[model samples]
Target: MGSDSHHQDGVGVPDELDRLWTPHRMAYISGANKPADGTPGECPFCRVPGLDDEEGLVVHRGEVSFVVLNLYPYSPGHLMVCPYRHVADYTELTEEELLEVARFTQRAMAVVRSVSGAHGFNIGMNQGAIAGAGIAAHLHQHVVPRWAGDQNFMPIIGRTKTLPQLMDETRRLLAKAWG
Candidate 1:
């Protein structure tokens, strides 16, 4: 209960929150790992659709928008609803893209809930770089499945998040669930 010499060591006192050393995330934040200028031709959102649905990890392919798994997910069953066009801002979406994005967002919620048995959901968009959008150049809506006590020290302390299901496995399952 009293102060120890170890507490006086260079390292600070440990608190309840564990540390996750996500060093690589810095590359994404700085736009060093993605296309240089964030143009449509160089964008992943623009390129993913050209690949087959399975290859793209796409759950559903609507007319203007699609649902795909988040490659770096905050949790299992995390999906993103995005327009095929490489638009950055939500307000920039055309009426058709807007409608399809909404529809696919709904579809993403339903499919993830049915397939992953998620107890709840976290749904939204991080509009810009300052708002924690990794790919701020693309407009995408996140649909994250939540179970009770999903938060834990593994991701927090170990810095390694373990998703129970492989992305391809999840893609197939969600694709089936979508249908």
Candidate 2:
């Protein structure tokens, strides 16, 4: 009776069980759920010299703006375009800085699409933390590369997203484009 019951719905059960038991995934979940200390100070991303070669991230930097790979990315080529100035909102930025940001964002989108073969992109800014801004103190624009079948059952069903490439590799590609 038990064997028959197990065999009755065996197709997706194995895959589901395997995903649920992944040790690395478990660790990631634990780490994500841990409470943050919420310390406030200088913006880590603003410190440029220390950032180079840190991870598979940080593609390039310019006079007014810089590009960084999203550490917790929604897609493979996810990136953020941030101004050098530490401003909380877009309104706080100088017109020159805003113009630079727009130019850099367009350049970044082209680079990401050309390098990653992304069919489309989602680019925008969240005004505040309450509006889903991860770093509310620093104004930045997100440039997320998208593909036809980018959305999958993993994120919807398993609450996990799979990235196809490393951030370092993406950075290399973007750096070449920036040059």
Candidate 3:
């Protein structure tokens, strides 16, 4: 690479580093859609249950907890098991809520495996903002389906993830399989 190759265009400066721009992720990083206050009315988890399954991208609706597709998924079939109530911490869940969330998480894993033939899974919760919880206001457990080579050059080398499936499509497959 020559020095002239680093010229700044209207968009940005050309550099040696390869660029894969994902403007959509800015909303997540900037917390544009995050609730202003950590309240039920402003929380997406609390609001998702009221919407129809298709609109909400919900895979399974349990009595106390529900399974919904991750809008910005780590993988194609990434799902979150969440309680209907707007609780910030896992310890805040009632016995019924806790049991249902656990059940939903198990079912989510099975459904993802059956639908996508996932080789493995990465499942857990980021308890607070400091712990990397995108929506720290609501307690939810992530169930990310993983294949043999899912962690390829894109995420590792380029700091990007290539998601082959769309949200609605993944939701449909998982929801159908969950039934």
In model 2, which runs have C-alpha deviations exceeding 4 angstroms?
1-40, 48-50, 53-56, 152-161
Candidate 3 global lDDT: 0.86
For every candidate in turn, the CA RMSD to the true structure comes to 4.3, 4.9, 3.7
- Top candidate on lDDT is 3
Error of 2 at 129 (Å): 1.1
Q: Find the candidate with the highest TM-score and give its number.
A: 3
lDDT of 1 by residue, 82-112 (tens): 9988889999999999988888888788888
| Residues 1-179, model 2: lDDT tens digits | 56677768784355432232334345444555222432234564455425554452678777787888776677777888888777778999998888888998899888887887888899999997699776677787999988775655565665655676656777787888878
- Number of the candidate with higher TM-score, 2 or 3: 3
lDDT of 3 by residue, 1-179 (tens): 56555563424463344455556667777887688878888898888899999999999898899999987777789899999888899999999999999889888889999999999999999999899988899999999988876666555666555677778989999999998
Candidate 1 residues lying further than 4 Å off, grouped into runs, are 1-33, 152-161
In angstroms, the error of model 3 at 16 is: 9.3
Query: What global local distance difference test value does model 2 have?
Result: 0.72
TM match of model 3 to true structure? 0.85
Better of 2 and 3 by lDDT: 3
Ranking by TM-score: 3, 1, 2
TM-score for every candidate vs. truth? Answer: 0.80, 0.73, 0.85
